[model samples]
Target: MQMTKRSLPRATPEQVGIVAKQVIAFLDDVRKHESELHSFMLLRHGQVAAEGWWAPYTPELPHMLFSLSKSFTSTAIGMAVHEGIITLDDTVVSFFPDDLPGDVSEHLAAMQIRHLLMMGTGHDQDTMDALIAAEDGNWVRAFLELPVPHEPGTHFLYNTGATYMLSAILQKVSGRTLIDYLTPRLFEPLCIENPTWDICPRGINTGGFGLNVTTEDIAKFGQLYLQKGLWNGVRIIDEEWVNEATSKQISNGDGGDSDWAQGYGYQFWRCRHEIYRGDGAFGQFCIVMPEQDAVIAITAGTGDMQVILNSVWDHLLPGFLPDPVVTDESSVALSEYLAKLQLEVPQLRSESMLEAQVSGKRYEIEQDQMEQAPFPLKDFCIEFDTDSARLTLKLECEDSIILGREHWLSESTITIEGKDTRIAGSFTWKSEAELVLTLQAIETPFRVTLEVHFIDDAVTIHSRYNVGWDKVNTVHGRAVD
Candidate 1:
């Protein structure tokens, strides 16, 4: 299928029955609290009302979807079912007889494609570790060998392995990897170009995770489902499948006020106030609200996902008016605010009293100093030129120089945590004796901050990640020459 260029129409929030002031409030709330938010897009009536990306993260780059990939995998299975290539009731073992264990247990035999779709695999815990660690590297055979502790359809376990099994089954039946299979059908129709998914050792797509898509691509997905599988007046997926896939398939937990506790569909989670979402770890969300005819896509690295949803409920949900509201002063203000939205660079005075002492100085780290650091530290040097400043980091044998500037300066290559990555960094002096360096990995949603403190002839280094790790790594070094 030939791909066509498609773009969602743009609109002012008030033009689509949304309050611009409330949307601004929502963005402000997120800015104040959710420091790790990467990008966000809000669409109403098939038109983009607001969209913004935090600096260092842009709309063009494909952000890691994590578990949000499950929803896409589920959509593929739905399409396969529509085409009669497979059925929901098909026994999983039936597809891979050669890989099955010698004697399949009753629970394993009873498991069906539908069970995997709904995360109802009878396993009590996640099975990914075992699948990944399989000595022969045959994930299918490894999955089949594991014993099912409970009946397939009766248990509710958030299992990525189950989704992987679904992807494997799809490949076996269709003879195409999930990415290739969906390219012409789902991706091309939506204009999601050059999409990528991680593959297992056996060449199957990692169904439950490892999808990379832009925030707008994510919005298109949610909008597709909200439109009941129709895009630009064409039926991409069967309407019946969309309904079944988005509706509750299993009772994940007691229907609590928490969106997560509401229920589970086919790789989708039922949310509060009649909404459903596909979310990934650390906060990648594609939220669909049917009653309001709206979709929200967000990419973030925040620890508290609930706070994001709550802000939406409080700020955006109520702003959805029944009819378009008149353009007011607030609407104009919102447009300007959205235009100027940015993740500010850390502010610090340019000059430092210790600049002369640390300039062109090499420090040798003590052996005991390496214990507290994330990476083995051998030695480091700081240098400042008229145009830029740099810190040459020596970890064991590998050496990398991180550039620092008053503004964010993009570096094409830098090594962090032993991986070569493209990063943007800026330097600021917290005090005459302390220099702070902030480095953001452009491809991933993480930033590393290093604080270099000059105390007499000794230099102390402190390092921490913006999200994920809790503890700070510290190392001490003294001038070697």
Candidate 2:
């Protein structure tokens, strides 16, 4: 079954009982804090109230939803339980006898599928790193061998490996991958097309992360939950499952008025204001507000996720009234503002005298120096042109990326996180001797900025990510030929 159109019906903010000016305030707050949001969508009463995507980040492209993927993993598990293929009381070891450790402890043996869904697997720390580093690349074995000190359902750790185990269990019982399992029941019903989920070395979907879908897809998922698992008057999942999946299942100890403190459900974080959300690292959110009859979906590359929610509560929350208010003036202002939304491009300060001298120079970086780079770049060369510049980076082979002198240029084959996605870049002269190249991964909340300083016959390159573990990496190179 194919969906007629992959979008919900559109309605003015006032038509959906939302004040346009308040939405403007929410957007203004985002800009004031310089939050790098790629897209935003607001849905009220099953209609789209507002939607926008920053330039170069189109609505059609899929954005990576790190742990937000866990929510979908949870949905699949709930479906499996509903079909009687699996049960919440099923022991984790029961599904994987072949992968069990030599000596399963009492705590490990006691772990249940429910514990994995609520992230109460009795693990002391996140098992993600250890699973990825397993020598034999057997993540299931690695996870099973880990020590479970606390009794199942007693400890509350945000364990991602536990979610992966849920995926493994579903696959074992259903004989299908997570994506395949959800296709007929979820994606097709919602008209979410061509979504991608990265897999482990063993071909299991990385259940806790690596799912990519459009902003609309996220909003639809939230709406499905808001409607108690009903889509177009058809029951996609049991209403009982939706209630159990979204209700607080455990205390996360993240106390305070903070959203994280509200508690945790099945792969969903309960937020302040009686809301529950599925969120990913770097600000991918599927926020469902049942009381207000609304859903807010967002994708961003911001360091502070709390501030974004604060914007929603402080500005947008009060505007959701029970009846429509006069919003003609504010609605026009918002329309004008949303149409003009675009990410600022780097501007060239001035013409550089050194540009001609280094136009076609190749720089050879040593292995020790290259180690500092985020990408395994062996060498690099820059070729200047009248209107654009070509950056040649040697990875497995030479990859050329173009940067428009005045605007952002796009290259579709740039590999990021083992996936080929489009990248938009622009170059600017920081100074006569310094040049900066900014590359944005169009489908993700990530950008890499390279600052190259030319001095004598050597060049120093500093690479930085807008949001990541390491802030900066530096490498030195000598001019070659």
Candidate 3:
């Protein structure tokens, strides 16, 4: 399934019938709304029309896809059906007879692969949390034991566990993991390189979430779907599969102005304007607008995901004309704007006399004393230089990173959530008594900010994320050195 020398063509926005002004407006709207987008790519007529990465987030890094992984999992199932390895009519329990509960209910017995595909697993609530908490670590068994209160394919619930079950079923029938099976079938065919997906304790890919790929990779996948499974005239997947997968298969909400109420497809969400998209938590999106022969891929760390889609509808949608527009200086202006896109870095507002007083001083925090601790480190120390500061964090092990005083210092290293990853950081003195430190995980859509107050012989640090949970967490410590 691997191909050679096949990449999406690049062109000016005018060449692709996209108005550069409107596209620029879209960018403006994003910033105006305070949406922290990491990267974006716009495609039309099978060519890349516009693309940009917010600095600190480069083109080469793989961003966490979160729930966007479900769409790829759905594609694997479609291929399995095409190859005769599995069928939509296949019973869920039939694939894992040994893992079934002691007494399967009628509703559980009737659950089908097609039901899982549509997120209609007959469970009234999301089963993922309970399944992962089963303690025994047998996810398959845990899923089967969960009560199915309704008939399969009747109720509509956004159940992630259904997608995991599909992955489990695919692995059981194919004797390979989701990634292994899709390597030759999807990833290799599309030239998606070295994608990483998290696995559960049982060694199965966590199909409902945990996928990472570059923004371009996501664009290519969306383009493939836009092309009806054809890549460079080669049929990577069946056209029929693409047609069915993106079409509405279940009603998820009341048809209103809200996009979430549109409908639900195989693993895609039916959108307004005759669009279907695969989206993830915190605004990762792969939106396919078939009517306009366009695709948009975006990654972000913003709490208000609706604002992103709203901006698209308000700005970008109007630019898609039936014919390509004439070349103009606006296209050049748009290019220049995209080339310079970058997130703001913290700048020093005042000189901190406290810097010289507390520099190289280690402050040890007692965990039991923290009113609200966002980080788990036991101690922290700061070393200041003319242009940058080095921060040392001591937990089970020691980690350090350098933060530029008024600019982002690249190529920094830190351990976040048990994973050692690259980071870019900046620091600024808010006043004579407080310091603000910012760290951005370059490979993920996450930025952590800490405001530290030095008072007498003690320090209080307040931490918060730009997206997701924004509540500030506070911890206090006494200087130990």
Using TM-score, give the best candidate's number: 2
Give the distance in Å from residue 424's predicted Cα in candidate 2 to where it truly belongs: 0.3
Ten-residue region with minimum lDDT total, candidate 1: 1-10
lDDT for model 3, on a 0 to 1 scale? 0.88
Arrange candidates, best lDDT first.
2, 3, 1
Off by over 4 Å in 3: 1-6, 348-350, 369-373
Over the stretch 1-481, how does candidate 1's per-residue lDDT look in tens digits?
1213666788888788998889989988887885478888999998898888877677788888989999999999999999999999999999999998989999999999999998888988888988999998899998889989999988899989889999999999999999999999999889997788889888999998988888989999999998999887889989999899989999988877688888899999999898999999888999999999999999988788898998999999989999999989998888788677655666787778778879988888888777554545677787876546877777645554556566677754666555556777778888889988887776666777888898888899888877778888888899988
Ranking by TM-score: 2, 3, 1
Please write out the lDDT profile of model 2 over residues 1-481, one tens digit for every residue.
Answer: 1123678888899988999999999999999998889999999998889999998788898999999999999999999989999999999999888999889999999999999999999999999999999888889999999999999898789999999998888888999999999999999999999989888889898899989999999999999999999998889989999999999999997668688878889999998888999999999999999999999999999999999999999999988999877868989999999988888887867468899998889998877867554756678888888878999887666678888775778754665455576888888899999999888888889888888999988998888888874768888898888
Model 3 Cα lDDT, one tens digit per residue, 198-309? 8878989989898899999999999889989988778877889899999999999897778888989899999988999999999999999999999999999888888999
Give the alpha-carbon lDDT of every model.
0.85, 0.89, 0.88
State every prediction's TM-score relative to the real structure.
0.90, 0.97, 0.96
TM-score of candidate 3 versus the correct structure, residues matched by position: 0.96
Clashes in predicted model 2: 0
Ten contiguous residues with the weakest lDDT in model 2: 1-10
For lDDT, candidate 1 versus 2, the one ahead is 2
For model 1, which pairs clash? none
